[model samples]
Target: MRAILVLLIIVVLVAIAAIALGFVNVSQTRTASLPTISVKGGSAPAFNVQTANVSVGVENHVVQTPTVDVKKP
Candidate 1:
C-alpha cells in the first residue's frame, strides 16, 4: 500500500513536471537552445569526519523445548 502511494505521488509529480516543462503540450512557440557555460577551476571543501564502525555477526545456539502432553477427549 505504501509503495502504491509513493508510486502515485511520483507519477503525479512527473506529470506536473512534464506539464510545467511544456513537454505535454503539443504547441511550441520557439525552439529551445542550450546555454553556453564557462567553467573555472575550483577546489572542493574537505571535511575530517569521524564515524563509528559497527560489526555484525550471527552466532549459532542450541535450545531445549519442553514437550507438550495432549489428552484426547
Candidate 2:
C-alpha cells in the first residue's frame, strides 16, 4: 500500500510538471521572418472570362422529439 501511494504521488507530480511546462510553452512569444517574391514585366496575352450566378438553398427538419431522463436513488 505504501509503495502504491508513493507511485501515485510520483505520477501526479509528473502530470503537474508536464502541465506547468505546457503552460510555459504556450505563454512564450516567438518571432519569425518570411521571404517575399516579386514578378518582373513579361509579354503576356490578355484574356476575358465570364462567370454565371449560382443559387443555393438549405433546409432542415426535425423528425422526432429529443429528451433526456435522469434518475436518482
Candidate 3:
C-alpha cells in the first residue's frame, strides 16, 4: 500500500539522518570525546564539550586538545 511505502520512506529517512549525524561508531577510540550532559528544569538537557590531550608517534611527539567553554545553561 501507499501508506506502508510512505512509512518505510520516513523510517529510512530517519535512519539516514541519524547515520549522517555521526550517531554510531564501531570503535570507541575513533570517537574524539564524549559530551557532558546537564539537566535543567527537571527535563531540559544540554551538553558541555569534552576534550582530551593526545600524544602520537615516537621520539618526536605532539600534544593537542580542544579548548571548550565551561559555561552551563
Candidate 4:
C-alpha cells in the first residue's frame, strides 16, 4: 500500500511538472489591420470579445451502453 501511494505521488508530481513546462509557448504579439465597420447613422455599436484564445482538443473515448432485447412469447 505504501509503495502504491509513493508511485501515485510521483506520477502526480511528474504530471504537474509536465503541465507547467508545456504551457511555455513563445507566441509573440503582432498587430494586423482588420476590417472596421461603421454604422450609417452614427450610433455606438458594441462588441463582446475582449481577449479570446481558441483551442480545439480531440480525444477518443469509448462508452458502453446496455441494451435490452425483448422477445415476443
Candidate 5:
C-alpha cells in the first residue's frame, strides 16, 4: 500500500511538472516574419492583327486478356 501511494505521488508530481512546463512554453512569445506581396495593374499593351493554321491527330489502343485461374484448399 505504501509503495502504491508513493508511486501515485510520483506520478502526480510528474504530471504537475509536465503541466507547468507546458504552461511556460505556451506563455513564451514567438518571433517570426512572414512574406507579403502587392500587385497593381498598369496600362495595357496595344493589340496587333495575327493569323495562324494548326492541325492535330490522336490515336488510342486497347489490350485483351485470355485466361485467369485461381485455386484454394
Candidate 6:
C-alpha cells in the first residue's frame, strides 16, 4: 500500500513537471462567456414591526466568602 501511494505521488509529480515543461499541451477549443442578465427595477415591500419595550436593571448581594492562606517552606 505504501509503495503504491509513493508511486502515485511520483506519477503526479512527473505529470505536473511535464505539463510545466510544455511536454503536455492542453487547450480549450471553444470560447466561453457568461450569459447577460437584465434585472427590472422594482420597489421592495415595506415592513411594519411593533416591538415590546424592555427594562434592564442590576441587583447587588453581599455574601461571605472563605479566604485561603498558602505557606511555602
Q: What local distance difference test score does each model get?
A: 0.96, 0.87, 0.84, 0.85, 0.84, 0.99
lDDT of 4: 0.85
Candidate 3: where is the Cα deviation over 4 Å?
Answer: 26-73
Q: Model 6, range 1-73, lDDT digits (tens) per residue?
A: 9999999999999999999999999999999999999999999999999999999999999999999999998
lDDT tens readout by residue for model 4, 1-73: 9999999999999888877899534565997888998768666788898887999999999999999999999
Instruction: Report the lDDT tens digits of candidate 5 across residue range 7-58.
Output: 9999999888988888534455888888898879888799998879777889
Model 1 off-target regions past 4 Å? 1-29, 64-73
User: How do the candidates rank by lDDT, highest first?
Assistant: 6, 1, 2, 4, 5, 3
Over 4-69, each residue of candidate 3 has an lDDT whose tens digit, in order, gives 999999999988888888885445556476899996666568899989989887696688989998
- Number of the top lDDT candidate: 6
lDDT of 2: 0.87
In candidate 6, position 60 carries an lDDT of 100
**lDDT digits (tens) for residues 1-73 of candidate 1:** 9999999999999999999998898678999999999999999999999999999999999999999999999
Q: How accurate is candidate 5 locally (lDDT)?
A: 0.84
Candidate that would win on TM-score: 6
Off by over 4 Å in 2: 23-73
TM-score of each: 0.36, 0.31, 0.33, 0.31, 0.31, 0.47
Worst 10 residues of 2 by lDDT: 23-32
Model 1 has an lDDT value of 0.96
Candidate 1: clashing pairs of residues:
none
- Each candidate structure's count of clashing pairs: 0, 0, 0, 0, 0, 0
Better model by TM-score: candidate 1 vs candidate 2: 1
Q: Which residue pairs collide in model 6, if any?
A: none
